[model samples]
Target chain A: MAILNLKKIGVSGVNSALHKIVENSEKDFEIRNPQGQHSIACGINAPLNVEIKGHVGFYCGGMNKYAKILIHGHAGVGVGENMMSGYIHVKGDTSESAGATAHGGFLVIEGNASSRCGISMKGVDIVVGGSVGHMSGFMAQSGNLVICGDAKDALGDSIYEANIFVRGEVSELGADCIEKEVRPEHSAKISKLLKSSGINANPTDFRRYGSARQLYNFDVDNFESY
Target chain B: MSEDIPKTHPRKSATFDDYTLSEIRRAAATGIYDIRGGGAKRSVPGLDDLLFLGASLSRYPLEGYREYCGTDIVLGSRFATNPLKLKIPITIAGMSFGSLSAQAKEALGRGASIAGTSTTTGDGGMTKEEREQSEILIYQYLPSRYGMNPDDLRKADAIEIVVGQGAKPGGGGMLLGQKISDRVAEMRNLPKGIDQRSACRHPDWTGPDDLEIKIHELREISDWKKPIFIKIGGARPYYDTALSVKAGADVIVIDGMQGGTAATQEVFIENVGQPTLACIRPAVKALQELGMHRKVQLIVSGGIRNGADVAKAIALGADAVSIGTAALVALGDNNPELEDEYKKLGTTAGAFDDWHEGLDPAGISTQDPDLSKRLDPVTAGRKLSNYLKVMTMELQTIARACGKSHVLNLEPEDLVALTVEAAAIAQVPLCGTDWIPGKKNEILLS
Candidate 1:
């Protein structure tokens, strides 16, 4: 295990140190004093275990692949953004666009997440512990977004093939997005995601929401929806 | 008595032209607006209105065969560790694999490699064949982030953050169901036979301030090795250019309304943005005001056709120019050879812009198996290389005639405009007079 302090070396040094780790090494690293700095521990390509001790800013752990990152405090916008393959565990709440456009990854937010969570997610599986704000899961292409607590307004707007599992009430649904029955397979999938993210929740208690697919092809009837 | 009879002269309304009337009828019949490929077709004051002022009695011209005029340029030298060194100032603009056949993308890569320039990937992510064929490939980071991954980002030579395209400046990209094959569907992570509309704005961040941070993240991802380019449409060129520079871009690509799109509404194409001729000077002025001219490179595109357009763009203070529509034309798009097939599709060879239909006879802008196989990548690549070579030669000829040792040495003083609109837009003097329409000068040619 190696210890790197952000206050001591700055963002560039911390990133360089993370990049130096070899692929599949599964190395352990502890970063101290993140100080809400942006882009800390970003672009990690190797299979390493990284733990950030304090709060972080935008794009923390962005485009991360093959690494397992644990954020000890709150994170700002776009954490784990565009990540290809990795595991990011945020211990506290996150700001808007959390896990935005991530292709493939497992992002577990233990606390509440702000608006636009899981927006445009390609294939990542995100499990949120607390409530999420408005416009969550907007335009999600392919993935599973599991929200254990209540969800705010306009949930799953313009969603694609991705599935959304929400436990509590939702204010509204966006175009082409609708609530569907939670089947046995969905329960199993949600259960697996929750177990993997270490969240204790009954899969049957949640409802599945996805695209009605009405807006998939352009038609004059759906013009008002657009 | 019948011989003395006179017939009333027939007249037509200029406002309701033939094309306009046809469009109105078509819209009334089908409740959908027209969607097509390529750029605005209406004539605008562009490079054709400008003429090079060759060497006269006051200046000496270089020997055509003996004197050397350098065409080489280096892009991304401002902040990047390793910049692209090209033998010419012409580059291939971004065009996606979903909108175009894989063979077309490969052909563009191969041709650009042979021409010693770069090619860019578009909305649909980078393809493996394109990566293998291209010597220098610029990965476009778009709002949709379709097929966006870290492995490909690392594989790319440079990263271009696409804020907006010229064809639909404020609008998003649309890939109709006809063009979305199984492969394209998997890459974009969408249903196989559904319309895909990309977001006009990026999902993660907004505004220039956020863009600066986004650029930082990308730089960290690439270890600050790759050059970052910010591509903007012709709308608000001056402010956009300055903002891009402030956002830590090593290169700024300003695409005018004449730039091509794979598929977009015709109204947005014709009604949205400024012409190529009207966009350059303001962008250049922004760079000069910041004292970053020549430090941060500018690559301009839209309506670039021949070598004259290339030279004219450089003289207007662009470091390089990119071609999209012209490159496709060189690769046999809308060829007269396919005239019969085009007519069968209810359009002439030169007027075939329904690329969204995916029934292209030339096979460049299609995903149909049979149609796509018609275009041989090697042959098409060779044709594009040949066209690039000719354009480069023509540019050198103009530079030599203007008594310049390098193609970049050509300045605004080396050219004169034929029309008042051209002179005003290009910020150059009108021919036979020293009058620039918008500028007030103390001394004038009398």
Candidate 2:
């Protein structure tokens, strides 16, 4: 597999190189020292393994399909944004807006992630091992947000159609972000997800949160003047 | 101590509203006339005065107001097209709550819906009021992605990727630090009192190459069903339109400099952009060269005043026209009743545009409680609807006068340009001429 030294190219030229890697490389490829820049690995539908080292800018693994991307360092805003179907792992700290609006994928951030981690997330399974920032899953429509560590603030503001489980302190819950009963239906699934993500945390320590469906159909009676 | 350079010296004195003194002050401040945004601010010939040359031997004029004037349209007929079916060509332009007050935006949506068109939400997150009132909501995907969600994207009738706006072409948004209320702040995930600085370039895209991927990401996020539109400020629009089409945009929304905003630097407003008059022709030219002219429905905005202007814009190759300033006016902004308030603000009626101050007397311009109360959504919405209907009728009258059954049927042959800029860009003929460059087709204007 080819090693793409990202410092050698500008942001615009990176896509072609990644596309070439997807076409040419059979095994996982390695990219080194990528400073914060946009669109590191976009629209790759192949079932390939890609590792990006160093801080990455927005949309690192966006529109990803079938490929598995691993970022070794910190990530900028909107990392793994809008990923269709893939696996994205951020080993270090992440900036605000990680995993924004991803349709279907598994996003795992090992360290702390800033606010709006799973904003408008769709059909993705996000697992944050460390503490998560404020508004972690603001307006999340579907999918799941699992925080093993402390959740800073507004854990799930204006959330709808999403399953959320937080293991630690939630500074504040967002509007319409309500707690739901964690019945026997979710026990097996939660435990399996925690173990697979390499986190041996107790499933019983987590509490589930989701939408109240209050703002779905806006009416004078239902609308809250916001 | 009375020093040599006194505080009240001639140099420090007011020149009594003297034109020359003000001119000197302006000249000292800047070398040229200061302006901003992307529309024509200079006085150039417009479609208002242009009398169409109806069909003589080959073409004929339809009875004015009697014959049908078809204005129906569907965008994204090209490679990357929106899947929406529109009954009318006119659609509401995206205006943010941070720009225009909450009420004004609601009124625009009301008007658009009444006219069987679509309304769009801007940089701010979707307001429940807008979603409830608007029949078809075109949710905007801005760089900030404020309040963006997969559910909203899927729920929207269409999605517009706003790369830039006409008001501050290539410049980031600045809704002054003062306007950020608790709600606005909460909506944007910003500090309550901090200046809202938007990144001019989207974080997801570094250039056209990345834009392609971003579009794909959006398509993936939305499950590839909703129509996706790429909006650009009218700067280098010829290439912007073509490249956007290449980058997988189903529809291209081209906004010219004349488009209004709630708040922009005064310097940027008057000086930065080509007039809407100049933007249309080049965009159409680029579309024609790519052979995607009418295929990619072009929606043009900026300085659209009367129905005649709308008709001209469409004849010049726009599928429809979107208005911001006009729509606001229809809702009683600058109304004579607010003259007292205008006087208090050091301006007069019809001249007070304190849109920056958020003290809108007509609720259509401000989020203030007393001011917002002045604007009854239902009544104001109806007025806006009436205005839109009148504009459409005027356009129909013009189309019929040009002997065309449909607004789109009014060809370029019906127009004549008085200036070279107008001629070259608008594709209209020189005044008193059957002679158009490469006039290989029917000559009706002669």
Q: Pick the candidate with the highest TM-score.
A: 1
lDDT over C-alpha atoms for residue A68 of model 1: 96
Query: How high is the CA lDDT of each candidate model?
Result: 0.93, 0.73
Encode model 2's per-residue lDDT on B1-446: one tens digit a residue: 65666485355445545745675697576543332222344465555535566556676777765667787887655433347776666777887776566676777778778988888888776887788778888999887665665556767888899988776778766555556677777676554655454546664456776688677656644545677888888788888988987887878888777787666665566566666777787888888898888777788888788888888888888888877777778888888888887788766766665575666666765556677777777788888888888888888887887788888876677787765446656767767765454443444564
Looking at candidate 2, what TM-score does chain B attain?
0.87
> Distance (Å) between predicted and true CA of A189, model 2?
26
Chain A agreement with the truth for model 1, given as TM-score:
0.97
- The 10-residue segment of model 1 chain A with minimum total lDDT is A17-26
- lDDT (10s digit) by residue, model 1, range B88-112: 9999999999999999999999999
What are the per-residue Cα lDDT tens digits for candidate 2 across A1-226? Answer: 7677778865434555555543445557788778876667765656778898888876788767788999989887778887778799998888777787676788889898887788767567888888888877876767888998988778787676788998988888888788899987666668877776776789998899987766443234543523
The numbered model that scores best in lDDT is 1
Assess the local accuracy of residue B43 in candidate 1 as a C-alpha lDDT between 0 and 100: 87
Q: Distance from true position, residue B9, model 1, in Å? A: 3.3
**Can you give the DockQ of every candidate in the order shown?**
0.88, 0.06
